[model samples]
Target: MPHFRIETNVPKSKIPQDFVSKAIPVLAKALGKPEQYCVVSLIAEVPMNFGGSTDPCAIGNLMSIGALGVEQNKKHAKVLFELVERELGVPQDRMYITFQDEPTGNVGFKGTTFHSLFG
Candidate 1:
C-alpha cells in the first residue's frame, strides 16, 4: 500500500517521459511492498519554492499502511531523492520528502478497507 507521489517545480516536459514505469519498482523496493500494490503519481510544473527561492525542487509524499520507520524512512528518502534527481534533474538538496503511515482502516481498495482484510 505504498503510494509514492511527487510534486515538482520542474516542467513535465523536462522529466523523463517514462518515469512512471521506472518509478514503480523503485517505490516498491523502498517500501518493501509488491510492485503490483505500489502506486506512483507525479505532478510536475507545480509552483513550489524550497528555501524561499524558485529553483528545481520537489516534495515527495510516501503513504503506506506500514513499513515506515526512522531507518527505513531515511533509506527511502535517499533512494527516492536519487531517483528524482536522475529522472527529473532536480537537485536532491532542494527536495523534501514526507512519510506518512496511514492506518489500515483509513485506506481502502476495491470497496474494502485494509483494516477489514488484515487488521
Candidate 2:
C-alpha cells in the first residue's frame, strides 16, 4: 500500500478536487502500483509559517509514501511539487517531500496486515 500524508498552509476547503484525482493516478504510475493501492490523507496547517536555514520556504511534506533513494525520491518530489503548484497554487520553492518505506510486515488493515491481505 502507498500512503500519502500531505500537510499544507493552504486551507483544506481550498484544495482542488482535480488535484486529488490527478495525484492518485500520477503517484500510482510513478510507484508502479494500482491506483486502488494508494491511500491519501490531507492535513491543513493554518497559521503556519514556512522558512528556515536548512530548507528555506518549506511549506510541508509533498510525498510520504515509500522509501526510495535520494535521486529517485527527488524525481518524485519534482512531480509532486509541480502538481501542487499547478493545482493547489502552492509554489514549488515552498515545499519539501520525504519518503519512508514501511517494513514488509509492519502495515496492517481492518483485521489483518497488508501482507496478510495480499498473501
Candidate 3:
C-alpha cells in the first residue's frame, strides 16, 4: 500500500473537489503501484508555516511497503509536488514531502498485516 497524506495551510474551499481523483492515478504511476492499493488524503486549512511564512505551504508523506528509495523518491517528489501545486495551488518550493519505506509487518490491510499475508 502507498498512502500519500498532505497537510496544507490552504483553505478547504480553495482545494479542488477533484483533487483526490487526480492524485491517485498520478501517485500510483509514480510509485509503480496499483491504484487500488494506493490512498491519498488532504488535510486543508491546517495551521502550518514554512520558512516563517504561511502562504499555502504543505507537509506531506508517502508511506509504502516498497518503491521508495533515494533515487526513486526524487522522481516521486517531482510528480507529487506537481500534483499538489496543481490541485492546492501550493508551490513546489513551499511543500515538503517525506518518503517512508514501510515494513510489511507494520502495515495492516484486510484484517491482517501485510507481513502475515505476504510471508
Per-prediction TM-score to the true structure, in the order listed:
0.95, 0.77, 0.96
Candidate 2: Cα lDDT at 49: 62
* Highest TM-score against the true fold, candidate: 3
lDDT of 2 by residue, 21-98 (tens): 778887777676788878666666445566643322334443333545677777777777777777766778777666
**What's the TM for model 3?**
0.96
How large an RMSD does model 3 have?
Answer: 0.8
At residue 22, give the lDDT of candidate 1: 99
Candidate lDDT scores, in order, read: 0.91, 0.66, 0.93
lDDT of 2 at 33: 70
Clashing pairs in 3: none
Better of 1 and 2 by TM-score: 1
Give me the displacement of residue 111 in model 3, in angstroms.
1.5
Per-residue lDDT over 19-74 for candidate 3, one digit per residue giving the tens place of the 0 to 100 score: 98889999999988999999999888999989999888999999999899999999
Ranking by lDDT: 3, 1, 2
lDDT, candidate 3, residue 75? 94
* Segments of candidate 3 deviating more than 4 angstroms: none
Model 2 clashing residue pairs (backbone): 67-101
